[model samples]
Target: MDIFELDSAFVLHTYARRKIAFERGENATLFDQNGDDYIDFASGIGVNSVGHGNGRLAAAIADQASKIIHSSNLYTIAIQARLAERVVRLSGLDARVFFANSGAEANEGAIKLARKYGQNSGRFEIITLRNSFHGRTIATLKATGQEKFHARFGPFPDGFVYAADTEDVLRKIGGRTAAAMVELVQGEGGVLPLDEEAVRNLAAELKKRDILLIADEVQTGVFRSGEFTASIGYSIEPDIFTLAKGLGGGVPIGAVVTTKKELFEYGDHASTFGGNFLSARAAYTVLEILEEIKNSGKLARTIGYFARKNGEISAKYPRLFLGEAGVGLMRALIAKDDLIQQAVLERAHKERVLVLRSGGSRVRMLPPLTISKEEIDLGFQRLDSACRAADF
Candidate 1:
């Protein structure tokens, strides 16, 4: 059977899958069944930080799979404990962990942690910023602050307040607030970043009010934005942080890390597949590679290059591009209209380059963190051609 036919037969039509059927990938390139190569900028929607089929990642997954695919959370998994140690150490926070399988799950776990912190006081509300995105889980969907996602997902759990501005946030932070959650950069919200001053002030106010500060670092973690977490770049530490997406390279693992250890009591929450042996092993390998890159100063050097390159691109293509907003590799190239955006994406694909659209209007690029200078140039050349052809 044809690949598309096979997928259409069983899979739910939730995602608008592109026409290409990829068989394998190396670095930022994917190959179809017919051996056609395409430069990948989506990086599995920012999940594959290192890249597709990375040699180190493959060996780690294989090694762990051979030993044990999974073991329940009832017993200790040494790899999980070790990974937790590394994450907490890098996060520069006194924290414990609760792992899950996706960004949404991580956000859910964070919500629970905050709620439980104020359960006795009946303060269950979470303050979320306008245009912020958390995840697809029911609670997170309601917390997303986007009306489009809230459709048909009700009756949602209550106590989610979408603050319009810093003053609004302060006004909304009264007796019911258990936590104030935010994303320094809203990945799915057209790549719009929150005001740094606003975020800092809000965090400070939340601290003054004794409300937990939650950073949903699902899309901005694991060195995506030049830092391990975007919160670090913003210089504001959160009480509880939700992480996933790029955490385990390509492996499925999400986690909630709190500011202090013992944030959540035993039996308060749990997940069967969270922090499983295999996923933890994968996370450890990813961390090891990150540490190596950091120690070599490669991480800082690469981020510097990315920022300079982003500026150059914006200057070179002023008409085709609107502007750029990003710290490192987590960047976006704004197009004027959806029609132009669609044309560029299609033309880019024809030229064997893959890109993704954010919120139907903007083109988002999250190439592998391991993408070299040569690969970046090649992909940009192809994208430039497509963008030029798709003049608005």
Candidate 2:
């Protein structure tokens, strides 16, 4: 009879969730059915870049739905082509794109691209960063660097190896190495940023050895890091990059963008729902808003400034805020203990501030890029109060 009771009956509990149900959201705030407002920091796990019910996004989606929602990939979609052009133009990486339904699907396409490129080369292995998070699919789960995800999912798609640095990476790659996949920020790995030096060396080495370097930009793309993609912050150019999360501006879409030379000739890969007209319109809307945000520089600077501000917060309360790490809008505050994490999350929820847990002991914050400085201040104040009142 109750909403939570209905959810409990139908939903399998794969995630350790907070006990709250949001009825609707606007900008960076969510309201429960009872009319309590919560300052949103998770932003649906970084999917809502332009924030809830963005006028432009809603209009674009509505316009496209009125005209056409989807057509088979066999017929060229004009909007999809336009979105692809914009993606290539902004990336400046001279890449083509293939759309997919979600982040995991984009990654699946990337893995397939690597395997296809490895054909007849006696190399079929992909090297991933240790503690890296890719996706939840079988191929991606196998390719994921974290061993925990492999639990009960195996006998997975073979030929995935995890290594930490250039040395270990080199050791892992042999005659069977096809691609070296990495994330600039390990979003699920406690927001750990990859070593830039290691990435540079690894990219160069992988390039020299003719191995494709795939950057998983799912959680770190579309100005979340004060730029187009977090990969830009590292200055490491990947051969193939998978993008999702923020790309659609809160719509369901994914893209695998890659170099002109890296794409398949014909029959290489495809997705039926990939570049449909509606999602393409959504992507275009997102990019347009991002351009405005970039031009303003206020939101960009504020997104970048939070790291330093949180760094100060970390110093002020070292016992509670162990530290802060991440780039741009995608950030995580290191909690001193798991109990603090749970307590802060619970209290924040009760106080109407939404947060998330990552890698066991971090409070993940993914406020929309459109979030205002005032909103950030308010949210952080609530979070601070929640932390202080939490039974740690």
**lDDT, candidates in the order shown:** 0.84, 0.84
- TM-scores, one per candidate: 0.96, 0.96
Q: Candidate 2's residue-wise lDDT over 251-325, tens digit each?
A: 789999988454577787878889899888999899999888888886668776676666765676677777888
Residue 364 Cα positional deviation in candidate 1, in Å, after optimal superposition: 0.8
lDDT for residue 244 in candidate 2, whole number 0-100: 93
Candidate 1 residue 96 Cα shift, in angstroms, is 0.8
Where model 2 places Cα greater than 4 Å from the true spot, the runs are 260-262
Per-residue error (Å), model 1, residue 276: 0.8
Q: What lDDT is reached at residue 309 by model 1?
A: 66
